[model samples]
Target chain A: MSSDVKRLSLILLFSPFALWIVLLILLPHIGMVALSLREKVAPRVYEFGFGNYIDFINEPIYWNTLLRTGSMSLLVTALALLIGFPVAYYIAKIAGKRSRGALFLMCLIPLWVSDLIRAFGWILLLRETGVISSFLIWTGMTDHGIEFLYNDVTVIIGLVYTVILFMIVPLVSTLDGMGDDMIEAGYNLGGNSLTVLRRIIIPYAMPGIVAGCIVVFMLTAGSYLTPILLGGKNSSWFTEQIYDQFITRFNWESGAAFGFLLLAFTSFVVWLGLRLSGQSLTNTVART
Target chain B: MARANTSKALLFGYQAYIVAFFVFLAAPLVAAGTFAFNDSLFPSLPWQGFTLDWFFNDTEPKLGMFHDRRLLRGLYYSFVIALMVSTLSVAVGTTNAFLFVRREFPYKNFFYILMIVPLVIPGVILGISILVLASNVANTADDRFGIELEFLRPGLFLVVLGQFSFITTITSLVITARLRKCDLSLEEAAYNLGAGRARVLFTITLPFLRPAMIASGIVAFLVSFENFNTTLFLVGSESPLTITMYDRMAKVGSTPVLNAVSFFLMVGSGLLALISVVVQRPAPSE
Candidate 1:
């Protein structure tokens, strides 16, 4: 190939990537960072400063919501891992070949639908006059319908439902590659299932577990619809604050600051998770 | 003997747990689907005679989703947006896949790491960042150049762009996975047999990638269709079905008509999921 032709083909292939990464991803994020740094001194007047970040520190509600959102996301990640691991184990290690694929597909069905639909489904079943409440009344478990919406527990349940599939997919893929003989050998050495799971399985599955946890944490923390819809007035989610800043308040500076705070917090947690678990970002991201 | 019995009991309990887990997963969706056909306007309650009004009615109070003009328009807009997003994502994704797999450049690792940034960034951030940048540009244009850029406004065009940003990562990953496994010997043979580069790409490379492209295209379409967080910030006067549904759910509360819409989305997406699974499944036989 001639030099010009080679150069042309190379540019053709690289230009799309350049336009996508540079124009879309890098520039917008940099713009957001710049927006966050702006301090509105007067009407249609602005200067670069840390006023927005300082404001976040000064307001207890703002920082508290950030803390609450972060901790809640951590809780959701723990819950998803706890709930998903056993199911993944079943589908990976215990199920027959034909049933394995079937079971795996079942896990994915809920994910294919929109999160709005999933949240809506929970509403139909959990509202005061909803199905589960009415069923409780009929079964004489309670005389009156109970309002299950707009609470912390309800929000957690909704989040767990939304993110558990992510945990399970990675978990199952990791476990499927493990040999049955490993488990058999653990048993042969008089180790119980718990010991084997703790000593052998957990360490083996660390990469996947960390990957799943990272994805779930980022998703749960960043999630807007679930917390907003299910938690309602009580949500107090940081994303809600960001939304208020941007849309309701039309304060893009503070919104941008809050957005960065979220990105930074989530990134720190993801970094810590990778560090503790000794998993590379590339490998973890590959599994996802 | 006691140990064996205990283990057997544990197995039984484990099976029961699995059953319960699936029930938990399916409860909400099943309830939503059931209430769609319920006779009452409210989504829940005692069975008020089976009726198709939620799906078919077009009267004063019981307007079905099909008859709801706003919802239908939202659905149309969603389709068009998803179509554009999936196409752009797949095209750029394929280009990136080729670049990553077949070429060597300086800072390739840096670019590879940069590519993963979109996948981890929250959807809300992605939406707002683009919004901020576009607004800044628009303001600058209006202030100095005395020009208006409608496309940069919070509209369907921006919505498509925002979705394509992250979706391209997924399609790129899928195509790269397939492209890595492609045998280069076949390409070499084609080159030796008097075939040009473009011809080889069109005939061999593209055909090899056809399955991954189709699969990722379906995934891209569905992801864009279901997207809400990013779309919410970018949407203007027009809304997609998810956004519209969110408005009704948040503002007006639940109606059986919304339940009807949920039913249709469930089925449509279920079929798409099934198709992708079937297409990606490895063929049988040794």
Candidate 2:
């Protein structure tokens, strides 16, 4: 086809989906942001004002929950990287080829399960009388099961478990794309493993590290199901508040405001994650 | 230089820890699946005996692991809802792919960002918005038109709609990525050769997108099957398989049956994913 005609055809083909995208998704999100400045009425009515944002900023619960959620997500991301990097490195670089695929697949089995099921399973495993407790008791570590569930431990565990795969896969893909030949090249130059790692491996794996961190971090931060299911009554997370505002309370304006806050928090963290890790948010998004 | 060797030991320790962590992370899931087959009614430990009876067993009150009706109903509902979600998402996604690749409408970047935003938004928020919107619609419709839309009244259709909001984005993104690889010029060439846009799409572009579409479909199904926050608000007295399992784990507090459901889902989805991997063959060389 001729260039002009092709361009014209492209224009023709794209119009409807583009319009739908704009209308359905873009408008709703923009509407959400717009609604954040308003006040809720009897039901669905939005009274235009800055009251919602004022309430949002003034509330200590919002700030504290928001801060804790962000920090928790960050902690989970860091923990996942610490935990997953070696496994990814081993499978991608050091492991024997015959066993590598099997091991990696085994690592991934949990990822395919539903988040709800996993959360429930975690509760069962971590409940004071549950399987994990039983194991602890049997080991004579304590006569009673340790208080693991409905605390910070279970929430952290749940978050880390859910998002760890995100961290590992990106790191694996980046490492595999790089291959391990560079390490040998560094070693041939009389450098030790640490030197090679610092000088060679880290630079190549930077993209993966950044990509993995952002993907996992954002997921953990925005998550509601994990914290709700595992955190129990005392271990409240902010997304639960947001969910309650929208669902049980039937407060749309407040819900919209809260959601907008969540969005901003996510975007800011994503931007920070990219900057700190030295990769673009675009890169991280694609990796996931 | 001497200190650097310590780093190696540390790395080794970290590696060992990771392997242990993998076991830690994965043990519960494996236990859940394994315990499902246990003849004992307990979720953990104390196996009465090895038996396939759980898979085929029936209790008089019908609370037996295999004989539960509500669980079966939930499974049926989940599958139906998943099927609906996958079908809708695939359609929207494929069309969005066509639009993304072939057309150059106004505010393209704006639309692109909008389509991608939901990927980042938590499921909780999305579910909340849909519930708000649907309930409002249902209420207004009842008052104004006196027309009762059962689906809009927080049931299967509501769940499907809620899921479509986010899962559709997943489908579109996957399809869009594949479609980007497919040069738009071919479709134009076919058009220049006098084939209509529909023909060009169905014959050429659709085939290229088939694998991706199938993948998107499977992912959509998986997403919907496990959907919680969104489905929670939208679901009625009946529940999906996951939600049912969740309620049992939370309210009733003790049921080996929940693990049975998990095992069934784990094995089922795992097998489907395995088949997809073998068939899709991610590595082009292999």
Candidate 3:
């Protein structure tokens, strides 16, 4: 192709990408930051300031929920990793080839459904008049049905259930690439299974672990439907505060501020997680 | 011998743990699916005989999803929105695949990182940011020129835009992966055979990308259909099925009708997922 033709083609190809990145992702976020930096001085009037962010710190409920949401998300990420690592290991290393494909498909089935449906499913099992409570009554474990929903534990469980597949996919892919001979070598060098795992497997899967943790943590922290539906009145999720600012109270200024606060929190934690795991974003992105 | 025996025990324990994990994963969905056919109105308790009333009944109290006008309309709206979002996303995604793979530019790595930002940020924040910017533009337009940009307001149009924003990033990733795997030699061979650039692109390049485009289209469709967090903010008067179902679950708690709807959604999405997987697999040799 001629240089002119090549340049034309390049520009044509680049236009859509440039438009999408600038108009959709870049500008909207910039607008959000700008909106957040302003203060509502009077009716239909505003001034640029940090008053919105200051409000977040001054209000105990706001900061408390932010901390709670952050901590809870960390807890959920840890739980997902703990639960997902073993299952991923089994799928990647232990299962026969045919069963490996089938097991991986089973892991992915939950993701086909929406988070709302999953939360609905949890409600069916954990609600006051739900299946597990009824089963417990039939088994004579308790005299009355227990409302298992609307607690921190329930929210954490729901979050873990929703995000475990994300954790497992990266884990399985990374673990699948690891050679079995390495494990045997570790065992041959006077190492037990635990030692082999600690030495040979976890180190090899560090990129996948970091990748999974970033995704699960982001999803957990940003989640809205699971916490609200499962936790109900006591949800106190930071996303709920943002929702109240925009939809309930119609305070767009503060809503934008809260949104940026959340983005910052998630970004900081993700950076911290990558540092601790000794993996960079490029490595995690490549593995996933 | 003792170490071997302990390893066997550990293997048994690992197998049992996997079984328990699968149970934990499958239990909630299974419970929800089971109660859809229960004879009772409530979604729990007594071994009520099987009935498809929740799927078929058009009564005052036991309104089925198929017969309910509002629910069906919501489903239709979701379908239309998903259709628009997927088409736009796939079209843009194809160009994105070409740009990222075949071309070189300054700040390419920076742009790539920017592309991933939409995926990582909270969906609600995405919704809110778009809402803020769009509305600000709309207000400015109305104030200065006395013009009404209805599309910028919180409506179905905004909903489609909100979903398309992030979903395009996903489709781009899928197509980019497929494009990276394409053999440039084949395109060179096409060019050597006296084919023009456009002709080569149409006949050789696009056909190679057909499966990926279809797969990403299916993914984009499913993501848009099931979206709630972004849709919740951008929805105007007309709500989609997810928002409608969310409202119902919040209000009525556990109704068998909702379970019936969940069953259908699960089956529908499962079939789409199956098709996408099948399409992405390489065709068998004769």
Candidate 4:
């Protein structure tokens, strides 16, 4: 092909993808950033200012909810890590070949369903007249059906349950690469199980751990459905605040500001997680 | 001897833990699936006689979910949106994968990373951003060019756009992974044989990419069909299956029909998951 034709073909092939990235991803974020800076001055008028961000800083309710959401997300990440690590270890290291595939499949299947359906499953199991409450009552554990839904505890459980697979998938892949001989070698060398786990296993899995934690933290922090459905009125999830601002109040400026704040907050948390875990973001994301 | 016994005990304990974990993971799904046949109006216990009323009932008192117009409409909308989004995503994603993997350009790494940002961004935030951006564009066009883009208004088109914006990234990544493993020699040999660039692409490159394209297309469709967070903000009047399901669960007390929906989804996705595992399974000799 001639150079001009080659160049033209390159542009032709590249423009759509380039336009997609620029128009859809980059421009919208730029729009959001611009929207975040402005404040509504009058009807149908928006003026550039930091007033929207200032409102977030000044309102204790807003920042408090953000902090609460962040902390709750942290808790969920930790719990998912706790529950997921052992299962991942079992599947990756201990299970026989056939059982390994089956176990992994069992973990993978739940993730295929929508988060809404998964949250609904939790509601069916935890509601006032739901299965767990009914089981407790029938077993004489309670006099009447207990309302187990619509609490922070329920929200945390739902969040952990929802994101645990994210944690496990990474951990399993990471652990699957680890050799059992290492563990056996550590035992033979008189290292206790805990010592080996702390020194060898944990270090080897740090990339996976960081990746899983980042994903779980981000998902939990920004999650709207599980918190709203399972936590009900008390669920002060920050994404709900963003939703309320955008959809409910029609305050695009405030919503844009909150959206940026969430992006910043989650990004910072992820960076901090990587820093603490001594994992590079590129490596962690690659593992994921 | 003592160490061996202790390790054996630990193995047993870990085995029990795994069993308990599976139970924890599976119990909620089992509970939900159970109510699909419960014949009870509510999804909760007190098992009414086992019946398929939720799946097939046509009468007024307890019409099956499939017989419900609103739900069927939602399902129709979901499928249509999924179809559009998957087609668009696959086309864009396949092209981008070729560009990223085969061709080099300035700021390629930067654009690649930028594309990945959408994947990690919360779907709710992504929806809001696109909604804001598209609405602004529509307003600007009306003010300046007097052209009202009806598609920009929240609807199936917007939903498809919202979903495609992020899902394309996933599709591209899938294809890119496959492309990385593909041998480029075959294409080079085709070119050496006097095959034109387009011919080489069609006859060699595309055939090699068919599996990745199909797989990613299926994934894109599934992701779009089940999307709620992004779709919720962008959906103007038409509620997809997920949004409809959420509405029923939240506003109206969900019935066994919802459980029936969940059952069908589980079965469908379960089969897909099984198929994927089987397809991905390594050869026995290997």
Stretch of 10 with least lDDT, candidate 3 chain A:
A279-288
Quality of candidate 1 docking, DockQ: 0.80
Worst 10 residues of 2 chain A by lDDT: A16-25
DockQ of each: 0.80, 0.42, 0.76, 0.66
- How would the candidate models be sorted by lDDT, starting from the highest? 1, 3, 4, 2
User: Cα RMSD to native, each candidate?
Assistant: 1.5, 4.0, 1.5, 2.2
Error of 4 at A222 (Å): 1.3
- Alpha-carbon RMSD, candidate 1: 1.5
TM-score of chain B of each: 0.96, 0.87, 0.97, 0.92
The residue-by-residue lDDT of candidate 4 on A216-253, one tens digit each, is 88888878899998988778889999999988998989
TM-scores of the candidates are 0.97, 0.86, 0.97, 0.94
Q: Alpha-carbon error at A17 in model 3, in Å? A: 0.9
Native interface contact recovery, model 3: 0.75
> Model 2: what is its DockQ?
0.42
Instruction: Write the candidate numbers in order of decreasing TM-score.
Output: 1, 3, 4, 2
* Candidate 1 lDDT over residue span A1-288, tens digit each: 898987898899999999999878889999999999999999989999999999999999999999999999999999999999999999999888999999999999899788998998999899999988999999999998899999999999999999999999989988888998988899899998789999999988887898799889999999999998899877999888989999999999999999999999999999998888888777877655
User: In model 3, which runs have C-alpha deviations exceeding 4 angstroms?
Assistant: none
lDDT of each: 0.91, 0.77, 0.90, 0.86
Better of 1 and 2 by DockQ: 1
Clashes of each: 0, 2, 0, 0
